[model samples]
Target: MKELAGQTALVTGGTAGIGLESARLLARHGATVIITGRSQQRGEAAVAELGAGVRFVAADLADLESVQALVRHCGDQVDIVVNNAASFPGALTVEQDVTSFESTFDTNVRGAYFLVAALAPAMLRRGHGSIVNVTSMVAFKGVPGASSYSASKAALESLTRSWAAEFGPHGVRVNSVAPGPTATAGVTAEWGDVNDELGRALPLGRTAQAAEIAEAVLFLASPRSSFVTGSTLHADGGGVAA
Candidate 1:
């Protein structure tokens, strides 16, 4: 039997990159995976790629109303929720008359927070579940030119601990995965020339593959990790250790 047999999972930001990989891993482990993407087109494409027993939903994290709708649409108690959709609105962007902080927090932190809030009640009633926030090494070591985004991840990390404590007695676990620079399309563009600098400094000497991080997520989300909660798994290629 698959590790995740007889489970149902929801993965946010599942249209691309790490989220896509994580969702696929869960599906392969025998979970019915429902993935979310901002664009309907991309969501449909992602569902197609995931094959049978996999599905998609469209939810733009920046919008609270959309998030609520997405949760309601999620249907039934979910065994796992991978909060993997987030944005890195690099340097100096602003939202709602404030600064980039608002935009960054809205999508990265608030979206995940509210979605979990909506889902947790149902999960708790079911008496078993897991929540995995797709955080970044930036949450701890910090990343330049992405202060707002990093701050958002840091905030989510805090929530992971808090949620773990609050929900543990109910048999729900909340944890995080902080990945280093993975070779995603977005990261490929962000790398330019400085990417190698981090790799050289890292003990592993190279960025992790998306599937590597996805496997870590699967571990944390599985019964295999039932005793582990509130921890941040660093899939950072030793970036922080270096």
Candidate 2:
């Protein structure tokens, strides 16, 4: 039998990149996967591509109403929650505007915070669930032009520990996966060759693939890491070490 045959998973920002890959992995393991994205077209495309047992929900993490609507749609049967939706607006600290900074936190931190707050009660009631927050290595190390993004991820990493403590007693596990420079579609589009250049500095000498990071997410979401909680699994290509 598949390890996640009887489970259900909800992946935010799951229409592409690491989020989509994570959804694919969870579904492959037999979980009924629900993916969310701001674009209905992309969400439907993801569902179609993923095939049976995977569905898509339209949501905007930056909006509170959308988050609530998403929670309502989920209806409390999610065994795994992958908080992978985030906004990365790169700008130096002094050059960053208030709007972008707020938007970053609203989407990356507040959105995930409220989503977990709303979903965790159901997990607590059932006494078994897992939450894997997709953070970044930038949360630990300083990165130029990524002040807001890095701070938001750092907040998420902190929340993982807090949530683990709050929910672990009830049999729910909360952890985080921090990926370094990854070759996701969005990253490829935005950073172009810079990602490769950055990867060369890492000990592994290459940027990670989305699937590689997704595998880490899968481990944390699955029973394989049943004893692990409040931990940040670094899926980075040794960027944290270097």
Candidate 3:
């Protein structure tokens, strides 16, 4: 039997990169996966690529109304949630605009918060569910141009612990996965060779792949991690340790 048979998973920002890979893995394990993205076109393409057992939902995590609508659409069928949607505006603190900072927080922190707030009650009632937040190594180690992004992820990590404590007792587990420099299309496009450069500096000597990070998400989302909660699994090529 598949590990996630009969489960339903919702992966935010799942049109591409780590989010898309995570959705693929969950569906491969027999979960009905719902992937969300701001573009209906991309979402539909992703669903088509992933084939059966995966569907797409249109959502903009930076918008509260969209987030709420997404929650309503999912209703109470979500057995797993992957908070993978985030906005990465890389700018020095002095150079960072207010709009960029707010947008980062709105998508990364506020969106995840409300999603959990709305979905957790159902998990509590059912007495079993998992939430895996896709954080970043910047939350643990400072990065030159990631002030807002880092802070947002740090906030999510803190919430992971709090949610774990609040929901763990009720049989719902919450945790986080922090990835270092990864060679995703967006990251590669934005950072160019910087990701590879950073990866070489890490203890593992290479940047991570989207699929590698998705594997970590799969572990936390499945019963394989039944006893794990409130902890951060660093899939960062040992960047945090280095």
**TM-scores for every candidate against the unseen true structure:** 0.93, 0.98, 0.98
lDDT of 1 at 56: 87
Candidate 3 lDDT by residue in tens digits, 61-84: 999999999999999999999999
| Decoy 1 TM-score against native | 0.93
lDDT of 1 by residue, 112-214 (tens): 9999998898888888999999999878885566677788899999999999999999999999999987877767675554555665667888877888999
**Candidate 2, 1-242: lDDT as tens digits:** 99999999999999999999999999999999999999999999999899999999999999999999999999989999999999887788999999999998999999999999999999999999999999999999887887899999999999999999999999999999999999888887766787788888899998999999999999999999999999999988888888
Q: What RMSD, rounded to one decimal, does every model reach?
A: 2.2, 0.8, 0.7
Task: List the candidate 1 regions with Cα displacement exceeding 4 Å.
Answer: 92-99
Q: After superposition, how far is residue 35 of candidate 3 from its true place, in Å?
A: 0.2
- On the 0 to 100 scale, the lDDT of residue 150 in model 1 is 82
Q: Which number leads on lDDT? A: 3
Poorest stretch of ten by lDDT in candidate 1: 91-100
Off by over 4 Å in 2: none
